[model samples]
Target: MMVLDGEELDQLYVDPSWQSRGIGNRLVDLAKTQSPTGLALWTFQVNAPAQRFYERHGFVAVEHTDGSRNEEREPDIRYEWRRGPVRP
Candidate 1:
């Protein structure tokens, strides 16, 4: 039940022990139904694994957003998915 910007999915975590069991995929699928077009999320620029997962789920890198907040910040990447069509 976590949400962001009233239109995004954030911090979707499956227990480390449950990793790779397709639980995360299922949750993402569920979230898609509730989202407009589809979901969007941000992950650390270094998290290649997560970026791959999102790509498998049909997300594409739209841009990179500021990771700054009063000095405690890190680079983050923004990804988005469209349940409809992808514009070129």
Candidate 2:
């Protein structure tokens, strides 16, 4: 996982075979710890599983693009996360 511009999360990936195994959870948690104020990242629109994963981790979809800004030129969604209220 890489944090860009001090607050953007990039290149956060786990091998497909390694997915659904909590590695993602750990990485996201670590990202939160490192970027407690806020964090943002983009994922292809076709990656529904990734979108769900980030949503479960408290990220909310805030913007979408027609693949114009990225090199791949694929439709994408942007998600943002902020430190929420304490649970207890």
Candidate 3:
């Protein structure tokens, strides 16, 4: 079991070969069942595919922040799914 949050998700990685094979969707579904407040994650502004995947899973952009890591500033988007019932 993992506790998902903005910072945590920003560091998450999915294998390239397995990127769009519904692995992420299934992982998020598992997370939702274990999470008391549903699933949440963050993706970089340039990561359109991940953003779309999250949106398909009912996550919506809830916030944006300066993703400054090691003194480097980058745009990051935060998404959350707090109210939707997970799809079958």
Candidate 4:
């Protein structure tokens, strides 16, 4: 995970073999402690499971990219989480 300017969550990834084991949750929890006001991250559009995970953690989809701005040239989605009541 990469937190930029002590705010944005720039990157987050866990190996497939290490997923479903709570590491991500722990990391996010730590991130919250570091930046409780909010956090943001970008994930590939193809990663549906990641989207679900972030949503479960109170993050909401906020924006999308069309593969034109990343090194991997893949479409992506940006998610954000705020320190307050959850959104439905």
Candidate 5:
């Protein structure tokens, strides 16, 4: 998934059988590289696993919507990650 000007993450998915195998983390790393300043993504609130995975990767919950705007009408949360200062 690619977003210009660090706007958002369009999509990131791993096959269910490939989950828990670090693929998602690698993809997240790639996204960070692609958007060096930051990246944001929306995920369904019911997806607890996705939330945990994003949190573990340094993403913080920034906002939430109550199923009003989306076509699916499912509550969702927005998470963001900003590049931090480099350490020696």
Candidate 6:
């Protein structure tokens, strides 16, 4: 994963064949331990599963983009996880 001094979680990926075995969750937990203050990330808008996963982990969509800044030109959403309690 690409973390910027424990502030931003730039990327986290698990091979499709190895998914659903808790690897992604572990990685996210590690990121949280490293960056207890908070963490932020972006996922493509078309990726519903990813959005759900992040939401389950306490991340909330905080922003949106029209795909202009990314190489893939895909619309994306930014999610953020704050330090304390998870939102309900």
Cα error, residue 16 of model 5, in Å, equals: 0.5
RMSD after CA superposition, every candidate: 3.7, 1.7, 4.1, 3.3, 2.0, 3.0
Model 6 C-alpha RMSD vs. true structure (Å) is 3.0
Candidate 3 segments whose C-alpha is farther than 4 A from its true place? 1-11, 69-72, 84-88
Give a tens-digit lDDT track for model 1, residues 11-83.
6888889888889888788788778676788888888998999999989999885778414487788998888
Residues 22-76, model 4: lDDT tens digits: 9899888888889989998889999999899999998999999998999999999
* Top model number, lDDT: 6
Better of 3 and 6 by lDDT: 6
TM-scores for all candidates? 0.80, 0.89, 0.70, 0.84, 0.89, 0.88
For residue 77, model 4's alpha carbon misses the true position, in angstroms, by 0.6
User: Over all chains combined, what TM-score does candidate 6 have?
Assistant: 0.88
Model 1: pairs clashing at backbone N, Cα or C within 3 Å: none
Q: Write the per-residue lDDT of candidate 2 for residues 1-88, one digit (tens) a residue.
A: 4445667898688888998888889988888888889999999999999899899988999999999999999999999998878787
RMSD (Cα, Å) of candidate 4?
Answer: 3.3
Clashes of each: 0, 0, 0, 0, 0, 0
**Global CA lDDT of candidate 6, please?**
0.90
- Writing each residue's lDDT as its tens digit, candidate 5 over 17-83 gives 8888888888888888888889988999999999999999999999999979888999999999998
Q: Which digits, one per residue and each the tens of the lDDT, describe model 3 over residues 1-88?
A: 2345532443445678877676777677666666646556767888898788789888889988878752446788889778556489
Model 4 C-alpha lDDT versus the unseen true structure? 0.86
Each model's lDDT: 0.79, 0.88, 0.70, 0.86, 0.86, 0.90
In model 6, pairs of residues that clash are none
Of the two candidates 2 and 5, the one with more favorable lDDT, higher being better, is 2
Minimum summed lDDT over a 10-residue window in model 6 is located at 1-10
C-alpha lDDT (0 to 100) for residue 4 of candidate 1:
42
Find the number of clashing residue pairs for candidate 6. 0
